[model samples]
Target: MVKPTYSPRRRTGARANAPSSQRTLHLGGESNPGRIQPSTKAAPIDTMPITSDPALEPLHRATLRVIGKSPGTGLVLPQCHIASCAHVVGRGTPPGTELRVQPWGRQPVEVRLIAIDDNADLALLGPPVDAPCPVELQQLMPLPLDGQIQRGDRFAAIGFPKNTNTQTIQCEEIQAEYEFYTHRQNQPSLLKLKLGQFRPGFSGGGLLNLRTGRICGLVKETRDEYQNLGGRAIPIEDLIAFCRHAGLPLSHAEPPPAVASEQAQALAAFLQQLPKWQDLASRRLFVQWALLNHPHAGDYQPMGQNPAADAQALALATLGPGATDAGLDAARQLLQRVLEEPVGKATKAEAKRLLKLLDA
Candidate 1:
């Protein structure tokens, strides 16, 4: 991944050799001086691994995974439109290259690229007419409309980091005054944040307020190690400007209440029950059982399609807060089956690890 330019320094020469991820050039406008780094370039887009029971939120339903030869992240807006970094959505690839969006617990949908403003480093994507219902945009918190944000305000971010798993960073801070990206034309304003050690693939995701659950900004870039691990984001005002310019409808809804703790409890119960689950579709069936039978049903969406790695994911999820009595009994049975069956070394090791956890 390319590091973003920092120090608020003036550009002395043209950046022709910079990685495409950092090339935030203005389209159809005069050049400006600033730095840019696309969030999609955080990992290889082609190697997206599937995991069962991702513990997604309703808000997360609107956060789509953008995949192509160049994979990235996108957010479903009130217009049923997907918003992402221009570099991520507009990057050129081989012929027939298409943008595929995978919503939480649903089939992937292909979208039509609508408008791209390189100066703002923003792109608007609309779903095809035949595509399934757009993600739940109403669950998202629209920023500035809810209230004013200032320095020291707490925030959170969720995105498909490394094109592998859904990861989140909670309790990030607004560290500096908002500023414009002077390097691109029109000089769009961006939010400055103190996000230490951010993961890759969070580039096009929302910077949601911790208190109100509203989206304050769209993550843009991260500074180098010398710059103390700071990051940049496109402020909500800029996002509004893009929507208006693209003629797309924008929603200004209040974000829902926080549900992290509730979700955690539900996940714990589901993981605890998964070991004893012996069915044709263990992951989905087990999670469904927990959601319906446990007290934490409101906290989580049921598990989606199961894969071979699901056993590993279930084992890992169980590590937090440990397992229940029923889980230990089920785990023992599962591990015995694995030991008696013909599976790979990795699977065998994973089974051993899970047995140890159950014993613990």
Candidate 2:
């Protein structure tokens, strides 16, 4: 239960959903307002976005603004997979149902329902055949999921809340690690949480553990009222277990391939130094080098950028970090495709090496 507190930017005042920053999110649905919007500062149109929160860095593209069962959020993980709550995507939603997802500032793309689990309230979707990814920034190294949760630990989630003029992200604590059963169900798969301004769009969002820089749960329920403020989420165990049973890459080995706690900080630091998705070849090479903790890793030219958008870079990050096999296949697929096209020797060689490593 070591809550590592190296938070250089512990959000002290001005919660993201404070009245000053809060927007309208009508409970009616997506059209209630429109598809949720990404933070201009987080995902700028003219320039690239940068983040100090190591835990949330590299996640902007991963956490997409979705309009599923309603105007809820979604997570676009490695292997071209998207995970969200069945409720938000429409519980009992049949496979083959086409849904549209709009990444921060990207255009809407269609995804097909590949799997759904009603008992667990989780659903998995796959990208269109013509499209390789739901979002352009595919080098998405999502934080690994912690096996368990302890009471009083701080957790955060980003989503499209109802009545919010703009999409918002919120953080709170586990009021109780115990399971909570709802009036609609017989099982107690949901864990209680201290709700803030979380509204409708919060469903299906991943609950991140602020301390370990790992995900701990899948948000399924939330309350907006400041008075009866309580929320519930499907614990990370259920999410991982479901991913495993579905033969997905999300939980690959279920260890910590996404990134170790110490490395997550290092990963975020390395990302902060760079601009934002530049020089695909160098960025891809740098990730593998950095993940291995090479001494001269930062010496690479043009260091101030975020490589989260590079699919190959993501493979390198996934390959080395906690050594999770999540993005290996996806990255390998993209690199193989790139090889078919004419490119520089360095780029070709690096792509080959990354593909080989993923194979190994």
Candidate 3:
């Protein structure tokens, strides 16, 4: 991959769980540790609360419409004419490849590609002009792994639909799996929005976690019946891995930094050592930690009933919590032995989970 040339701001080495810098101060002389007052400058008490209303937020308000025209004899060409589109695509592309949309009765305006995931039909565009408050990329959050996402779980879709200048809004819950596809064919997860207000031009928007506001997926398509389909967001963990592999800076808002090859060497060494340990307890913890921290493409279910499950259960039981540190070490060694054998071992599910845990 060609290296992205931008530099990123260096992150201060803060603990992952530390409080954010945007801490609010409380009035009235005293405050609870758990509750802080909003900053006075945030919003007036009498005015509408933008934070609570997704539509009111500047990010939600901004939208990018991908306008395309099909030449009679060739492929369709896409144009980013919307205001938000221009904001996101600014100065990001090479001279000729920069996105330009010809507005009615005027010359074309320039836009830049903020990011693009071709497999997901998602591309973030930036306007050529700057704004006082730029839209921020939402943080990735965790999802339930052991269960199915059911109907009625509230969700929000953000995107510029119908190649318009402003974003079309819709908040709703999953009605059902409107469609499904294999992983090889661009597995798009289709969702039915509660509100019946989805349209074209809303592709490449984000579907966010209602409670935490983290981005869970990228909106790719919407049916006239208000069915929303999206590609799951690239897991934060995977993003980190890709960045490391490509020697790109994790922070993108700033300039790029040099990455030493030693970091990659260290990561490879860690992965190599993981399967060699004998203790099951330690291995289990490590595996669980990996799954919890990583964003996977989908659930980790092993196939069918058989020795795979047995082997996995045995391995897990051998390493389950509370095993002595030494016992755990032993279990890890045994699991390695089991993995080495081609057949006659744990159920497929168990093996799959184990392998996934290790990969994560």
Candidate 4:
């Protein structure tokens, strides 16, 4: 898929060679730089071979196997919206192409494409035009508003893994885990999936975090990492951004107060104030400000050093002397993540940068 251009004007020059995914563009009046666009590329299709239990019946039932020229999976959402990988219903698909969806144990029914975000590798689908959805929907999957996942967290992906020519997919539930974020050149934003084995046909299926029993992502593709095979997934943050940009309803809920408080503590107040914790621009601004503007001048408080906004000193004053390394280290790592891989300043619009800053 071509990289989505956020610029309001139509791209010319070498960009003309790239396929257009922005089916709907806002070109007049106010300009938005962070504006997300559509895509026209498709990925190889696959299924998330996961077994179902009584507790996971809702997820299994709500998950759908999308039938296009090829098959893929889709997740049912509130308000009759269906979320899936953009490639499953790529903009390049034939206009007259008939699409159908079949929930677990339910009959296949017609569906229509509504919108796509190639930038985010996400697509939104609805019931057939001028027709209502007739499927017996199950409990819609919910997204954790914070979109946080710790390494090694237990995960169970649910969707229809495919079968072809009499080959079968393992129908047993297996362990999967969140490992790391992967940013490959010219590839869609992705999260690394740590799993042993998976059969094909999982694309567009929900990546369920077993600990929270909530979907944290959608399985995108399988990857061969070194000799160890693994999987790739779209992050929940991208899904959230897609919903926000496409005007689709998002089913999300915040983590518990204690969990949020812990996450906040794991981050520095400076970074915590940013909308996306991993946003390079916002973090860069804060880092630059701390280095040049803050009284501390980028250094932690030392004996006889300026203690402006010094939390270590305050903690010592209140809780007595103790190791505060964990919190400070976590904050440093959070900052390092963005600084190491910044979205180039020359590439993004300043207004959109400010909006991300202001959104915090």
Candidate 5:
């Protein structure tokens, strides 16, 4: 993996968490945390609030503050085990490296690294037999492994940062969007999320599902800062595998039943008519309403017998990266209807840009 450079800037408003100048997430391209502009819109505030839930309060105790020059974060799990990022504690820093963790409301305790999954960027820690009881991790039920994480699902993360006051840990709640799946890549295919500003200590903690208040996955790394290329997590399935590999016992909440094929097909049918809704707002709102009504039914997968392919082409043409000439042409062809007809200025401008990208 390529390394990313972090350029420092003058400290901004309240210093809740300090940015790491050396530590950076390598995701194929240059990711400068300083390049991300502050967002004006509070998507989380507009959508839903996760801070009020007492169920998530236990997460604070589970969060662990690493005390060092480049202090990071970790979370407590069952069986006196602590989970964190391998990179945070030094991936190749040899086994049994001495580390100190300040558990919530407790004195600093010495712990040693026991296991590290380099591929998943996960590490497990356990205290010496003589050490005090570690903070108890909440065994909240997890979202089903087979369930789909949609475009606008909300989640919260709790972590200890060196920049913040040692007494108080901050819990940041944000609305996350599922961007894409990368299967052929070096890393495992993860559900990439788009979130608001998160601090350095946010790493190594767990990404909690807001609705279920369960630890969905470990917060792996953050990408292009605030441009919606937020952070990545070791999706729930991968997290389970890591736990099993480390011989940790975990109790999962009963998963909801599989989404029926008929329902998925019907939702696909409804989304296909979005283009025919006469206006972009109506089309977008209609799709949103359908998803709102059938939250369980996942996004329509492209198939031979369905209109999913056309819908995908239209979507890809309009919003996706025109990486290839053929893809650009296909996008241009699909977007011609909107361009020719009076859909709206914004829609027409987007269509023209897609076409221009193809020409370029």
Candidate 6:
């Protein structure tokens, strides 16, 4: 397996040879001002070893065993073991070199080079020996359209944090903000997480949903105090892009085309059978799910008397208190259609009421 190397851009004049005492004397100074300071060249960063406890061994091994399968392939796994002080070395090494990752517990796993996005501190990993692939890549869950993640959600972190032998599995209630910034198109959005502990080895672990076991975010970083300092996970959407780029299989096992097609038909049929009141909510949920899990679903098209126009009108009428200014603008466009319609007095009255609330 080839390890990935990060070669930072060579800094100009940053590697000059040390000046001898004679040379220093010639400059009329005891120390050479041009010489790099020892502090500047000290070992990249100090890493702390997580305390070894027998209880954590299985979790650590389990995570490593699963992630270690693809030695040099850069597919990010749900379970990641991070050293206390691993620095993000830029792409400085040769392409095929096996990158040595020194996790806390077991032996160093030779990770194959996959892909590394320096801005995101995310690196894709291939399967390792004895590492079982997750049922899915964990990132296919639907994001709530409202963009709200409440506190107290149950979450788990799987990683080989300390060592290979120490599988420290940790689960906790989410408390603080999992603040995140994205630079995909130079447009950054702050995503806050609602759960989990930011333990040392859990850097690349998945922040998974307790209900469906789907992944919500990639474990990025945590606050130092572990108090209100919340841990951050990369959203699943980003993970999908990363995996696709790395060419890793999206699911642990591939299903036959017939089976997949049948599943899709069944879902559509089921939705069609729903009651009228349930239709909108069900369709909305389906649309959100399709957006993440089935990108091929095409764009969302509302259906009804006015179809797209009515859907937009409803969305405008129901803007939540937390709606942003941009969201409000979108609602206005939709509501305008409702106002322009020729309707009975009762219907028109209701529309006027909604428009009034929106204007307020």
Best by lDDT: 2
For model 1, the superposed segments whose C-alpha errors exceed 4 Å read 1-58, 91-98, 129-147, 163-186, 225-228, 251-360
**Which segments of model 2 are wrong by more than 4 Å?**
1-55, 129-131, 134-139, 163-185, 223-228, 252-360
Off by over 4 Å in 4: 1-55, 94-97, 138-146, 165-174, 225-228, 259-360
The TM-score that candidate 5 achieves is: 0.52
Writing each residue's lDDT as its tens digit, candidate 2 over 56-87 gives 54444457655676657777655877788887
Per-residue lDDT over 1-360 for candidate 3, one digit per residue giving the tens place of the 0 to 100 score:
222221121111101111101112121111221122223332222232134444324333322223332100000111221222111232233322445332211222344444433332333343454522122111111221111221123344443222111221122222112122223333332333333333443343444434333333334334443433322222222232233333333321221232323322332233334432234454444344333332221222222233333233333322332223333344344445445545333333454455454334
TM-score of 6: 0.40
lDDT-based ranking = 2, 5, 4, 1, 6, 3
lDDT of each: 0.46, 0.51, 0.30, 0.47, 0.49, 0.34
TM-score of each: 0.45, 0.52, 0.33, 0.57, 0.52, 0.40
Q: For residues 189-248, could you state the per-residue lDDT of candidate 4 as single tens digits? A: 576766534334566777777666777777777675232255777876667666655666
Residues 261-353 of candidate 1: C-alpha lDDT, one tens digit per residue: 332343344344444443436555444333223221121212334433343344333222233443334435545655665666765676676
lDDT, candidate 4, equals 0.47
Which residue runs of candidate 6 sit more than 4 Å off their true CA positions? Answer: 1-62, 65-94, 100-109, 127-153, 159-190, 194-199, 249-360
Residue-by-residue lDDT tens digits, candidate 5, 63-96: 6555432445676666677777877877675557
Which of the numbered candidates is closest to the native, going by highest TM-score? 4
Model 4, position 293, has a per-residue lDDT of 24
TM-score of 4: 0.57
